[model samples]
Target: MKHEKRWAIVSLASIPLVMTLGNSMLIPVLPTIEKKLNISSFQVSMIITLYSIVAIILIPIAGYLSDRIGRKKVIIPSLLIAGMGGIVSGWAAWKMDNPYILILIGRVLQGVGAAGAAPVVMPLVGDMFKSEKEVSKELGVIETSNTFGKVLSPILGSLLAGLVWFLPFFAIPIFCAISILLMLFLVKSPKMKKPVPFKKFFKTIKKIFKKNAKWLIAIFIIGCILMFVLFGVLFYLSTMLEDEHKIEGVKKGLILAIPLASLCIASFVTGKKIEENKVLMKWLTFIGILLSAGSVFAISFTENIYFLISIFFICGMGIGVALPCLDALITEGIEKEERGTITSIYSSMRFIGVASGPPLFVLLMKASHQVMYYTVTGICILAAIIALVGIKPKEIK
Candidate 1:
């Protein structure tokens, strides 16, 4: 990659970092919000759920729009809308005696913004780069940047929420604004010479899926399952520490960052190595899911924090390795014109996982610990089976 291109990747990469910050940063503070707002635990989970629910519905539409118009044009305005949502939620939290419903509304707008923005980055990265090797390397960096956000979100959310229960909500616009400025001035998206027409767009998509549906559908399911497991574990761990152990604030955040750090390292390493080697990517996906399943299954054997942390870290590492391969397979497999739409569908599935994780975990926690871990492990087993059988390198690459 050229120096200019590297800078553009950095600018584009910042979008996910910012978007992750806005959403994941609030996890630690959810208990605080529950107490302050006098809402139920499920309601606190709804704060996270509604955002992804909105995004899940609109992401395909945004993907279609980006394909129709252009990436930057869609992304810039989406950032502004997301920022505006932050402002609304922040104002509601800061000023109103009862801010729960209004805050959910703000999150809905943020979800709309997220629909148009972050998912578009995958296709945009594919658009800007020409070489498969470069795209793979850069996609790894993008994934790392995202996991890094997970690493930062808890720490930052804890710090801010310590000052005020609602401080993280206020911080969203500031992060989004910075992302906006970098995107506006620093990044240069490829010009679309001829946009796809509405009538032919669905036709093209249908054809792509018809030809590649086997691997594509497998990749989508794997993506969704990994995210669902990751978020579910994180939610379970968060509530366990804060409510059960009475762990609070930055200490809790730092503890949360451990598994995320393992995940980040795995993604960064695998992203560099998996370029164009469809066979290696296939095996990695299979092996990564196996690791995740085994780790979660190990969780059923112990309640010790040290042991649990080690197991979860391994699980995170497996997921981290698996995701970039999925990204590469899908991104490299699809044409540039169709990349945005297909990748957006992939992103939407991932969001559905995120949307479903917390609430589902909350309910699952009511059961035995064995049940929770085993349920997740079962999902991982399904993902692994899909990866092994469904992903044919000859077909995808």
Candidate 2:
């Protein structure tokens, strides 16, 4: 029980790793999915959107259920559902031969499972750690876990898809299984006496709406805008490499990884510093947004892969520095009980941004790649402005 805190952090952190891996692994293998399914590019885009749509719907419900039941109970089953979805998806990909439908099915189920676990995990972390400092550090670790998954996912997906079309689907179940094991062994939640009444729950929401609506709105919107900018740029970068530069296989993986690598390093460092100063956190985030915008803006001017990859690393680093702090600031401000609900709302906004980014950016690129990149650059700059001006930490009740 002494190292309960460390164990809890590890367990809570693993949940995001599983979730991120499942969501990102498809990026490298999107072309394979299109080839196998013989679907239009527009339809393939839905494979990603459908999952986000499901998470958007289910996240609030999951948060409410976790509050009523228990965090661990909800999380464990959610992992199982996600793992099972992976299995079904793999099987569907192999047996049905229509990879698109099967992938969508799997993504839908994964989304359902995602709703239950992803939003609740951070609140569980909040439950385990009392110190605002510890919460900030732990949230950094959790965000790192998410990026770590991104760092590994493309390589894993590329290797797996290289082996077989269905193999990438299997990676999800495996990650979920590992997450389930960690949650079972490591995460220990305090008991709750009774579920909050629906009437009271709504009243609390209304109260929060009236009081902290600005912060709540800002954080969620910021979360959404941040993800939109991050992923939209990623989508554009990947396509630029694949279609224009003609990079493929492991080389493509490494070039793509430059950004994620930068992000990983920034996340770890920012995590270390966040608790010491709120102003530092605010400035770090603001600077990160500036770096992100600058890097993308630079990438727009370059047709050279070398120039593009270098600027992308800077962009990635900025995003990396910004994300953990953003997560910490948002969840750290809320009470433990309300963390799940608020975090869910924040995550839903993030999913909305992420869901919109790929297709919308893809459309913009159809017109002009420069326009697409500039649009995302503007969004990141706006997000930076919002974080700098909108967020002012409050005393915890």
Which model scores highest in lDDT? Answer: 1
- lDDT of candidate 2 over 57-115, digit per residue (tens): 99988987887788988998998988988988888888884556776888899999998
Once superposed on the true structure, which residue ranges of model 2 sit more than 4 Å away at CA?
A: 394-397
lDDT by residue for model 1 (143-184), tens: 998889998989999999999878898899998898889988
TM-score of each: 0.98, 0.96
Instruction: Name the lDDT value of residue 216 in candidate 1.
Output: 95
**Could you tell me which 10 consecutive residues in candidate 1 have the lowest summed lDDT?**
192-201
Off by over 4 Å in 1: none
